[model samples]
Target chain A: MSSATLEIVEPGLLTTVQDAGRYGYQRFGVPVSGAIDVFALKAANILAGNAQDAAGLEMTVVGPRVRFLADTWIALTGADLGPLLDDRPIPMWESVAVPAGAILSFDGARDGVFGYLAVTGGIDVPVVMGSRSTYVKGAIGGHLGRALMASDSLPTMERDGHPDPTNNRLPDHLGAPRYGNTHEIRVVLGPQDAAFTAEAVQTLLGSEYSVSIQSDRMGYRLEGPVIQHRSGPDLISDGTPLGAVQVPGDGQPIILLSDRGTTGGYAKIATVISSDIGTLGQAMPVDTIRFATVSVEEAHAILREREQVLRDIEKAVRGAAAEAVSIRIDGDAFEAVDDSGRLVSAPAVEGRVESEATRHARVTVDGRTFEFDVEVQRAD
Target chain B: MREDLRFLPAGDQAVVVELGDTIDPQTNRRVHGLMDAIEREEVPGVFDLVPTYRSILVYYDPMLTSLPELQARVSELYRDLEDHAVATPRTVEIPTLYGGEYGPDLEFVAEHAGLTPQEVIDIHSGTDYLVYMMGFSPGFPYLGGLSERLATPRLDTPRLEIPAGSVGIAESQTGVYPVASPGGWRLVGRSPVRMFDAEAEPPSRLAAGDYVRFVPIASETEYLKLQESAVKGIHAGDAAQ
Candidate 1:
């Protein structure tokens, strides 16, 4: 007698519910907890026809095993973790329908670290200080503010229309980067860039740092050539916002992230641009990161470009065919039609779903195309 | 903050405006002045205004206003701010129980400060501290003006867990821990006051630029009683004798 949507069977490494972020409360020493790969989360939410900031599950290097309690459409993005629905492999970065009783599980991450999964309606969690993101340190927000464990049930957000949010597509160009071993994260020098010598600043940009094993949602600990500081790495303590590249006494540059302290004492050499934070977030442990400094004007320009690209994706979603279609992977293989109507290959699919009838259905099997009897369903 | 009134970009979403280089109370006042001025005017697109020790970080939506436009507005306010709108900080006197289990690192701080345990408590509660900023943990005030006699460095290796309400001293600063966390600060006492409560209005009990003092309680039972009162929505300021 409850509205539980998904029940966790195998709560893998670290899976937590997240949204855009918790804003405004950072001054109260609250971290803005959210998905590391925010762009990927946004893209996945978009593909599921949900609002860009809708709450979703963020899987870490590994993913959890969940069983659907209700029929829903879902989208997965960022890492190519071996996602399987019911037992068969499923697709990533596209909307897929899952009937009630389907069990979803992931084998392991083939690439990337964090993976985002968005349902048709967002994850229905009580927002703490205006965010669904989990700040586990505070034990607040997002499924009790910790990594989801076995037997945990997730609630689905209430929605009016568009029950089946499958078949929506995002252009590959605007999508967040998939599994990659390295990232060229852009930075805008200063806030504390003067704390370091000019040679050290050059060393920061010139040298490539590897994402250390100690990295987490709080900050990305880096291992690379130490960037020497003219003075000590301590400041009189100040507000350290997102993407602050704090050099500590150890000389390693730790790029603070979503769950970092509201303020810190370490001198920051530079800050990663808001646009490139998503890229930085997606870089897995042991991945190489090369820094490039740009002017603040250029940083703003880059962020504007990202915003424009998001607008383009939204426009494209609105411009699609009137009757939404379902791209299901039956038996084996994959195939789909691009927005331009060209035949394209697809990904794996869900375990099992027994849907009796549909308005219009198409099935592709072994290079042969099968179309179900056409039954028109119009919104107007 | 070497540059007076420097506007630094905090990524693309926020701007860090530095008031002064030093950690002087005047710099904090200026930071709070700008904060009050901005809060009163209520500029469009400015989402969150965070005031720190010597600077203010303004988080805004670039879609509504550009970096330069926000900078111009801030500059105008800085130029025109004749009256210090910064209010005299409210004084919060936290009732604390010192030494024993409540404060595990009491002896450490006592020896480090070259004072008897009783002298440590006396010196600690004697001075008034200004809430310089809040950081490290929720509602954890970064206080200024610990008595120089009680100044001590933090532990070389921090304890794995310090309970919430533990008043700690680290390198010339003293503040209560608002939440349970691993910290390097030497423990001196325990405060019954809830520094942060999500359900409470304003969330944080102590605001930046607020004045604070500690009231000494003799017994752990008194501390427990006050803790119960805090959970029931009553705070130390009201219960302080």
Candidate 2:
């Protein structure tokens, strides 16, 4: 089996390989580094016929310009970075097949802060501590434990025949997270909320907070209403979960993310719900965020709902692969015949099949019917 | 079960089991004790257990276990925590080179503490400090048991980058920076020990509930030799105990 290589032409602003996350080591002060917008990364992986946790390139603000060394399928998701294939605009959140030497580039972020690009077999980086996610602070995991640079070559794992790329996309209306300048982020009042004044809690939930300029992958420092603490902003340092809204002595809340320190000393008044963290991942500096309260049960329900959306996307991609049969004879359209020699209308099938086939072929009929013999005959 | 133990929700996936309010040895022991019990029980869906000063944050998957269920399980584990002994804490000796270039802020800290540089060094290295928790950065221990005589205020203006292994003091706290980062702590010495190695098993050299002792060396030559050995992948903590 031949492995493909992805060569970087330009490193853009910041791009690194990430996956689900590095876990089970937070106890030792290791941050669970992964793609910030997990939903987008998972969706990109699903569209590219890879596992949800497959390592992929996570681009921030701007995206890297890369050239594929071999023919492969890829999907772009998350922030709209104006991705282009060989100088032509390509669709986002959908799988696209690229021939060998095809160049993929981006024109900076148009909608959000982070974007994800997932390929067929995922980025073939050595898994460090059971994950390929990059923890830049520790200088561990991913491609050399750092962001991608120009002239760097990334290996791609070898896989069996590719999944049918057509119709493998997440529709925008189907619970896909939306990115904008202002977002309403939901939070659950935290383990340290009692340390803050009641007015501070109201201040967090009532006012708008803008992402500070000092924000990075570690966390977003927000500037907004001062969340006054009852006594002081210090606490017996405790474990900081992902999306922990910790306020320092200055009373400014910092929403910790994937690369956050495992433990922190500030009093965290609330924690952003897991379902809404992806939205924070897409927020740019100065982007305003209004906080809303949610019960833990409600947060779990939201997470389940988001998970169900992913499941639906996976089902749709698989269903499309099973139901559609793209039959192309020298780029000419041909009518497909069923097992009983009946002309069956194929609505799901799209794109040209790059194969020479004249013999027997099995295809799904009406989404429920079993294998039907598809006779690929010339229209002439 | 301790009457002060409070189970607080940290988002939807984690619970902060507060054993007590203060950062004392007894409270920290309970934190680790409960963590050990929970780990031994192998409760389903529990992924990571972080023992801090007086709390253990239990990270779990909401899909496999709900907050109430996890809280209940942890409560049960806490009830029986006193029956099981917490693991014996290890004392990792960190060899240090104090004063001069290795410790740029030594004179300042000495002046702040109203003691000579040697006296500050002697007091700082004399005690076996308890590793209360690891935080801020990887393998960076939050040590307790600092001598009040050696206590000094943090630098009013934090240095942009404090080199890794720089031993520093601030107010009532004293610890070493495991990595190069901007910090306000007043540096008194530098260690030749590598506190964190990402590629090594149990990456952090020190863990919560452990003890750390600073052994001061006389010369820069000795410091360089130890630093070279550390670079060669020799585990300093392994041999120094």
Candidate 3:
């Protein structure tokens, strides 16, 4: 049986359909709701043979219990959420097949904070304002504009002929993921760096900040040394970037995230570099983090190196053995059965339903076409 | 006295051009003007440009253009700032239902202003407003102009949730909540207009430099009907003036 749907048995701590992010909408105050650790999201998507920005599940802390109704390839990355298929421990950072009716479950995280699960063909949801990312605050985008609820079923896109993505793994040279209790987050000095006294800047650099319980997707509140300001920690409201360390009057630093407000009035003494934002995102409450300053050139070099690493992973995955069991159809081609058959639904393509006959079904499997007899049951 | 423009590095990818240290009409307008010039010239590698009260943040792809090159290019553009003509802002009149349930803190605002709710309505609606920028919530305008008399501080303890379209004042600024969310602004009215719609083209009803006029409405039933239409994209009384 070719399963094309994922039924949610448990929604985990907080699971949302996220992609690269909702871009170009920040001008109107739309938060860019993407994966906390985009590196993991990209890796998972690459392993699943989907576009790098394809919508995937971003699970926080714990992972979800999912049962597939179709054969699909999947890759898990980021935090080590102990995922098991049919009670068997599976490998992370590799594309693997999930047969129809296979139960995938996970216990609490063994390593990281946010785990990304990318399925072959990606999670198909209506693209709202140019993204599938879930910004729960505005009740916009992703699955029903909120976190995944129990018993909710997510749809996967249909794919055409291709080598099964299960023929992929994170090459050894790419290096294993790092999930440590403490992180040294690199930052670039700010647009309002002058607002803080030299002593405050030193205090920030010299002190260790722990992630506070008040942290969320919007911002990470760090509790530590009081970052004394020149006057007050207030600036005319201005556009805030991801990882901006906005210091309010309380002097505690708040590292803004992907879901941060478009503009902020608090003065940000410094901004965390893009590459370290993922590392910062994985810092759970009570996790220790210390600030380190890096030149912009160094930051760019780090980002470029990370990109090269992903490229190498993709190149290596191309040569691995196939381990996937899911059936996939091309976007241009799809499995067609009687409307009354067991497969209750699929992504609708208008005027694609050719006939009214309920006796036959045609499906494409592993690049070839096959037909099956169907017995339709009409509603009373 | 006007201050010279200063460029500040946000990160490797973004640079902020500070028009001034304070939020004034001319400084804010200059910020928006630079945004227009950047957009018109199609600054290479720029993926997003955000115009704020006194600064414009240009987020670019550093791989395509370096910060120094972009800054030099922007500096050249700023040299022509005095010659550039400002675009005429589009005016959208927001129909506000002041006092009573729509504004939970109406009395507080009136008492602070030393006026009746009716006078507060007159003063609030009488002046046209400038949208400093969009932030806080989707399509929520950070308006610059507010009547000094009507200025009220935020509630000592903010409500857990403020309904969408609740027009509030904080210090010398006034704005509406585009979506139902937790906020700390002092509410004095509610606008029936939907400030944001995910399905609409250009989601935010108001953009930076846009003009807003708060027109008062009486009936709650009428307000609800207009809100439904606003959600569907027809703002009952709004048109570019």
Candidate 4:
């Protein structure tokens, strides 16, 4: 129950272990390196009842073949890779129970450009500089402090299987992630908006650029219209953020991503809205990405809405777990299993157990059974 | 040109201070001093300030302060620190292995400098260079002050990869590539010491305003062990002893 081994049979285009991100320490010029599809990563971890920030495998378009040496619960989110649990089609966005010596394999991506595999207890990798994300350029953190190779083996740990009943609901409503050939990403004018000519700014927002093969964890090299500037180029090195669309001398826009350098010299005209960053994860080589302008206020509203949706999912999951008990349970300190099976204190006393919901139960100590009048719906 | 500053609106109560055509050292000094003055004043909404060679990019939480208020605060700081802006400098020495395989382009650099390969190494080792700034890749310093006699343009086509510690010249500037990357500079030598170790407290071996002097070594054999061990993630000091 201490650790398990994950041996890579074939390392795909790129498969690295990543956590939320390495934050702070920017003064030393360290990039905030981490997974691209954060929503999928968080969803996978939540389904397995692991910590939301737990590190997991981030597989690119070409996925890897791995063999787990022990039993565990795993959830595959992000790209629909046609994941097979013992050769049976397992649903995406749901946890799949695997027995000991199970082999999980994936072909190239089918729906999205990246996929995440989150185990119940999470990968037991050493954290460096306050994170487990791999910064390849800096060569710090994550399994042996580098990328996964063919013969690389990663150690896993026994999971407590404590599920957050609130986060267990399937996220199919967001739909199978779309990796459409052309994507229109929303953006807001950045701190350097006026640096470019008005026509150049219009071209950036109006053009449909094809993502070049040069795209990596650093940034996306986009090819489209030549955005000419009215002034001659002269840029001092400056700080830029992830999602900063920097148009360099050649006029091609490069959309910076996770693991981007701390600073840049290119004049940035706009920044992709934080809520739409997931669109970058879905873009593969030859994919087209369009930018639509939005007010900064609208961008903030979108971010808030996304955050609330994630929180609501977590709440529903926990509520469902508490509804399935049949016993007329008062606070007898009876051990209740969470969605992940780890013991947690039952909800505060005077908790009502609704009978219709199969996900949660309120057990009665003296053995009296009562069901709720109706299913309670949460207000938005 | 005289300096002028204006607040440009960036939606949702955010404004960026526009400093027109201020890409010179004199302006850089003024911009830096202004940033310092603002920090002393403790402007609201300002979360962080990133200063480059010429301009300062400020980040603030929009929920806390309005754009107009932040702009007013910056102008007040700018007007105060414009006169007293000067920075003291420091010098650092780098030991290098010149010529032979360690420096594949040593002959080319020598030819461009109108000297023999050994003489080229001497000229490079004899002079002190100034670090103008650090950019491009991490800890990759954009150095100035290479002698006009030794000026050389970058390779017509960049190499697929240049190893770390490789000392090279691109036009009038000389620098050491801190990380292995695709580069176009003309290599003339390489240093053994790690220039950009992430584990080190400072991370970068050199910083802006630091002075650099190259001290040359004749033997290429001295670098073989450090290069071999460094690539394998073992410190050269551990393997050398």
Candidate 5:
């Protein structure tokens, strides 16, 4: 058998292999570089039947064109990049099985700045300092510590079991986050809010800030009303956390992200909540952002709610796999499955089936009944 | 708990413990001391600790440990930090080649300090500087104890790219750039040593609570030989006397 691989035909702008993050080395000034949209990355991995922290490809603005070297399960999430599989539009937020030699391409992003592509068993990359994330500035981790280029052949891990294709889609009712040109981001005020005047805090909460063109994985610099400071902008350099909204002497606020320096001197007025960081990550250069302050307790509560939603998604996908069956309608076979109360049908060859001697058969899925005219054939 | 210690929440995952407002050696020692205490205790959910000039940022997983729980544990540790002994400082000697193309801003720095270029080198290499923190970029040390006489302002226009190992001075602070980056610091000399190597056992050459001593080399031929050896993985710091 041939080894599973993904050959890059055209590398997109700023495509990099990223996992959870590089942890435990911030003391030596190592940035924890990872996927900017953690939520989407996790969701993509889950849909592909990989671990939540598995390594995947993070594409910015434009996405890469690649060909699979072997038959494998894959998932696309994060942004609506107008992805096409073998010249056909594929559904987002679902597991898709691509045959060997199938080409996947994108026609630029319609909404959001970042998009994620995940494969079963995850991308095979050497884990450096406990992570596969790329820190391009320090030339550490990922594929040669830089963005992907054309002609790079990436290998995939060998997973233990097959992913159930029937119930692997995100239902419409449990809708994914929709990216737009405007975002209302929530933050927790201060490790250094005291350095700024009360009015400056008001300005941060009240005014609209446009995402500057200078934004990248390191930070999103905002151009908006001047956030006044009571004192100087300099602080004795301290550890900079992910989502730190730092305001410099220029009065511009830069929300630091995955690839920000481990420590910085600028005073941080607030930090975006964990649940909303992925939402901010999807904001484009010209997108307008408004800030809202939440208490630390409230932020944690929101995080818990987000975690519960993920759990619900996991249960919905995995729970329905047991009842998956193949149905034949008028001599044509279809994989009948429940996608969290949504009906899904796909062409399949295996599964327990119910065939009717009469012209119509009643099929029950997730407590809902549907009558279909079919030729009765028992595969068991 | 000490009256000076302030534990401020840095979002849901981290807490910044400020030891003092000033950037003095005493305060820095206490900062490292608290970090050492936390590390020795092996506190659950605490994943990373970043020690700076006068504070240590403690990063923890909120799912495993709540902010209030971490704060209570850290407060108790801060109260007993004095009992934790900070490791003895290591003085790493850096071999540097001074003047000419290597130090483009040397003449200007000397003119501003009212001294000859050689005098500037002498003053810079004479003192044993303290490494207060490693920040801004990977393995980039913020060294203190620059001579007041040699203190020079940053260049009017920042350089597009300062070569790695370039020793620079900005105001009262002096340090070496570990990687090539755009900077406005006044260059005095260039070191042959690699300040940071991701593949190395310890990525950063200098850590907080360490000392740096610059050793001047007279010949460019020796500098090239040292640079060559450094590329072959023979670090000059290990060979320093």
Candidate 6:
């Protein structure tokens, strides 16, 4: 089958193409600029069997109406959008086989603030600076480095095969990613914690604040008690990291997000844990926010557990698919070629009949070429 | 006093050291030396090395290394770094057109310095400034070592956007805004020279370890001609100067 196309009917409140993030250029003062709810974006892609970092539509508050130009497999996740297929209700958190020229319209979101749409084989957008994420401030990546507009056409790559309509289901609780709007976002006390008054620290965690209307991908300008810095001068600019809660002289806490400037002068009082950053990003304006403190060890344990869960899910998926075949290369060394034209030498594998499921193979030095049916196991 | 520097965990694997309240030249030099040492040792887990006026933030990976291990390595290098000599620095020359439309706020800065516009330019261009760091925007340098007489406060309110290549002074510090950004610094002059080029390998003409000296030119006609040739990618005339 040929590639599919999706013609946007009504562009939502805020819809943009997003990928993983921009990296490795922080030293030059460039922001990462990527998807706000990274966890949700990743899960949506994996559920659709797309690349982990594939570009997808990030719809916030309101989602767009799209009409498919060809048959494709797609999944809608993150927020609970009251979606209607030809005026008929369609459930969230499940794969849906879109027929040729079918209209997919999602109205106002009821649960979370952001929703994601992931198509199998992913959205095809030109990558800039190694990412397809839109950096609105710099106008760098994504689809022409801007938001999708009405009547814009997006092309989809070939799918693994349309997901069976019967298999279109997701966990009930996971239908819409839950948001405890008042949950204390766990954070590690910052290097500049001592620079603020003890009362300031107490006020930060104990009190509740509202996400201001000024919030965007750059940072969230929180409205609450003024966080005062006791004895720091106009600091010579320094590098700012993701989730850094910086308090400028004005006293309001601005939580820096994915597209925050690489360096800043304001004193950062706290840094939100990586696990909770996604929660903060999904919070809507006027949503109440509290703070909690977690030790470095606890954060690591949480991360490890999350990774394990992902690995388990992948394993389950792999078991349901075809089994891997093993092959061994003889005396000659095999050469591994990457997109960058650089080559690394590996042990040669013996030629063997490729399994029907094997699209690629890992050749071992002891004369064996392991069929590509196996999932990649990373050291981490 | 020989108290051990307290190393605090930032997040997953990053460590941040807060070297409390001192902007003395000696402290700044120590910060630079420590960064050089950490780079030389090549600690495996550490991915990014960021040094500021007082603190040094090191970002690392928890999977490959632990926080305590990275802290121990930093402590070891800190002790070893005390004996190293100052590394040779590169000097960057910025060609600027002082006063007139190119530097509309030049008169204001001159008045703040208690001198005529010509005398203010003389004192400002006389001293060499070090590039402390690159931040705010790409290739924008935060330079230190300004003459006390040339100190000027920023505008009462910031401008919505300032043009790129505009050089300004705020209090005792001076900097060049490499890209057009919202700023409040008291502008003194604008440079026809391009401080940043996205096409260039290094992208920035100046980096954290370099030094800078401003050279003032006369007349807008000369400035425009120089700018046109520079945009066409010329570098010959200034090198001869």
- In order, candidate lDDTs are 0.80, 0.83, 0.81, 0.69, 0.83, 0.71
Write one digit per residue (lDDT tens) for candidate 3, span B171-226: 88898888788888889889887878888778878888888999898889888887
A373: Cα error in model 3, Å? 53
Give a tens-digit lDDT track for model 2, residues A85-189. Answer: 999999888889988899999876789988999998889988888899999878889999898899898888865455555668775567455698999999999
DockQ of 6: 0.38
Off by over 4 Å in 1: A171-176, A320-380, B1-4, B103-119, B153-158, B234-241
Candidate achieving higher lDDT, 3 or 4: 3
Query: Whole-model lDDT for model 2 versus the true structure?
Result: 0.83
Q: Answer with 2 or 6, whichever has the higher TM-score.
A: 2
What C-alpha lDDT does candidate 1 achieve relative to the native structure? 0.80
- Report RMSD for candidate 6: 7.1
Candidate 5 C-alpha lDDT tens digits along A241-282: 989999999999999999999999899999998889899999
Off by over 4 Å in 4: A23-30, A137-140, A157-167, A170-181, A191-195, A231-234, A286-288, A318-380, B1-51, B56-90, B97-132, B157-161, B208-241
Candidate 6 runs further than 4 Å off: A1-8, A67-71, A83-94, A124-126, A151-176, A224-237, A249-252, A316-380, B1-5, B18-21, B24-42, B82-87, B197-201, B218-222, B229-241
The residue-by-residue lDDT of candidate 5 on B1-241, one tens digit each, is 3455787778877888888888887788777777878899877669888999988888887755788788788888887666346676789988898888888889988999999999999999999998888878888888889999888888889999999999999998899999899999999899988888877756777788788999998889999988888885524447555
TM-score of each: 0.85, 0.85, 0.86, 0.73, 0.85, 0.80
Candidate 1 displacement at residue A16 in angstroms: 0.6
Q: Please give the C-alpha DockQ score of model 4.
A: 0.17
- The prediction achieving the highest DockQ against the true structure is 3
TM-score of chain A of each: 0.82, 0.83, 0.82, 0.80, 0.83, 0.81
> Which residue pairs clash within candidate 5?
none
lDDT of 4 by residue, B53-140 (tens): 5555566655455555677778877766546444444567667888776688999988877899888887788887766456566677
Candidate 5: C-alpha lDDT: 0.83
Candidate numbers sorted by lDDT from highest down: 2, 5, 3, 1, 6, 4
Computed on C-alphas against the true complex, the DockQ of each candidate is 0.47, 0.53, 0.55, 0.17, 0.47, 0.38
| Winner by lDDT between candidate 3 and candidate 1 | 3
